[model samples]
Target: MKELDCLFVYPGAPAGKKNLLPIMPAGLLAMAAYLERNSVSAAIISLPSALDGEFDLPGIIRERRVKLVCIPAHWHRQAGGALRLAEQLKRAVPGVRIALGGYTASRFAAEILKEHPAVDFVVRGDGELPLLKLLGSLGTGGRSLGRVPNLAWRGKEGVTLNRTSYAAGSATLTGLGLAGLRFVLNRRLTPRRGICFEDGMFTYVQARGCADNCSACGGGRDAQRRMCGRRGVALKSPASVVRDFAELAAMGIKEIQLPLNPLPSDAYYIALLKLLMKKKLRPVLKIELCGLPSGKLLKWLGRALGPESKITIFAGSGSEKIRRLNRGRFYTNAGLMAALRLASRLGVKAWTAFTTGLPFETRRDFLATAALVRRMRREFKIGRSGVYVFSLEPGSPLFEDPEKYGVTLRRRTLKDFLAQRGKYDMGYSTACFTEREIVRNLKFLEKTAR
Candidate 1:
């Protein structure tokens, strides 16, 4: 076999830890594709898939002669798994270079490099260009590491952070081949399936970065600015997105999820919907709405996507006051119910989600959320509805300025996050709610779910 220049590994949570689902981000595949397009040999392996008896990871690494390995600690949940994998790979392969990237990694780049000796570098932000430059330097013995933008590396002096100079734009995102799954080495493994795949659905990214600055979302606008130097949402062209959808449909993907609202303006979403309509590709479409869509937009969605298409509304809290505080875009329960009514009339199933442990939520506030969920179940074409306890995200507003939100941070550093390996842990607390209170409320709210 020929030598591989780079291999991207997606880490799952450590054993007994219930963090995120075992799926890798769609963007990671795009990064791999970007490297391949640039004449670099790259492939992806899901750590969960490897551990599921799909293949021997170390043997494959040896066979491919992979020179560099990249792992993403995109979610704080993956912190333990990513670092553990890096350390294990170091012991198993002896000489392979390891790098970590993504939101969580970028936020704690210095700490990771300072503590984890196995991680040779942390590609802090928008990784494509930085990773390309890092690989180039590595091929020449890593003497030019300082020139790589958006990178953190240990030097003779100490840890060095290069300028975060590369923020990907629409053109860059359009060319990434985001739906390219052929590069995943263990794509066939069933036990390691992502949440979407488990539900017989696949996710397609139409944009990078988010416009909203939701208090709990690490991928929100301010978080993007802080982590990736991204100024605004970078959308894939409508034509590009339509083409990717067609490709996914061709690959027998029966349902596709556009994970977020994909917005800077609704015109962008409308244009993509029109393009998909023109293509007449009728894969079951699912979208997450950061805010309630207009009735016209709902009607258009019904026309464009046909039946079995769905939309999820993230009503973070049921109490209008609490919801307004936590969300960037505010909508009243009356407005949400109206939107749900419109969606149901248009034959589009709507799913609503709520979080129980937001900053100012009280027991009464949680009951309001529960009441909303019960009302949604009884009065709407709700495909699913549930309330979950919130986990603090590393780059979110609440995480960055906990004092401002009246939140007390529990896991503030890389080591602090990595210590929760054996069980589920919510990462923060508020004056009104203890972690125990949060869990109790979550259970109570869930009982109201259908």
Candidate 2:
């Protein structure tokens, strides 16, 4: 371990439609950028996002001589695969360290430590600092094993919980050299099936996190704490923000996806848009929009964005009460209608999302949602962009306060879900809703997609 050289590997996602969802592990890129900034040599291999199939993992690790392995926990599907890789790497190199992070790792540290004994440690929060610190400790052969918040280590006595504080929003996004890291991965994965999207489009952090306390969103307060151990949304400086996007635009990435809700105000967003336009680039814009845009605002955007701008709104729930329950500042149905009317008038293809079976929702609410969807389709002629229904994510407010919403919480072992992932025809059912209702509503929603 003379060289502070490390390899960051992102665990793969559940394989499904290949073209529609080409995976690129943003975390791995972030980790690589962090390690590189510390004057350490780091390389990232995003297995899920790899163009090469799973069969190529062994060769890649061998060639890279990977010392460290970092992966997030939601990528539970890759556990078996990652474990096998860890075993091989240790045998080949004799002292490889395996680290895990992300939502899954933070929550299920015990389960992962038990299941994958090969894993050296599990990182709890924003991983850049923890990873660097852990590597520094490993490099020096120091074994104090003091508390490191957001880390769980395996030792003689099962697992040791270190109070090493989980850090987030700690580093400057621009200072990380994201552009350089992207270039590195791109070169390594060139001419492969689907590498990084090198088109005139880029997705940067308009802000690090979200402000709206939507119960189901990952960025919500309780959810963020549970997931990343952070309380508030960590936003980047505006200069950094504009600089990153301008760099991406210069790289020929025209289209950009901004944040979901509680985004920058009209002035901030408009200014950013004008700056991009001043660069003489026209790109498709996707945003997490909510509530209704005023006629004046719509007209301004329509005139400013001209023909190339497209906005995507994620309403999250059609049931206003459910929306309110989920901490969505409920836009009156009138407000939603007004937005739809604006999109229709401006000839802008607006996309909206909603969910069903929100904890305490009734049949009337479901029908009301259905009716709204149908009316919007007929009135605005907005084509189908409806998300079928709601899911009770593990860290969401709904998961935390299910009882308050008249829903009983049911926990399923990880093994049960993993067993069902590969079977396409046997679609899995989560405990958020009864199997009967999910099927029925999915059928009802099919009318809109048709």
Write down the RMSD of all candidates, one decimal each. Answer: 2.2, 4.0
- Give one digit per residue, the lDDT tens place, for model 2 in 1-450: 233366666544433422322344355666677777787677666554445554354454556565566654544344444455566656765556778776556666777688776778888767777777777777677475454557788888788777636555624554663544552443344322233332333444454445556755545566666656676666555456567666666665656666454542455566665665566545566655654555665665665565666676666557777676765556677787777677767866667777665666667777777887887777755464575554444555655665556665443344433443331212223345464676577668657544
Clashing pairs in 1: none
Q: What is the lDDT of residue 36 in candidate 2?
A: 79
Report the number of the highest-TM-score candidate.
1
Point to the candidate with the largest lDDT: 1
Give the residue spans of candidate 1 off by over 4 A: 16-19, 50-54, 187-198, 262-264, 381-384, 421-424
Candidate 2 is scored at a TM of 0.83
Per-residue lDDT, model 2, residue 117, is 66
lDDT of 1 by residue, 86-113 (tens): 9999999989899999889999999999
What TM-score quantifies how close candidate 1 is to the native fold? 0.94
Residue 23's lDDT in candidate 2: 41
Q: Report lDDT per candidate.
A: 0.81, 0.59
The CA lDDT at 304 in model 2 is: 53
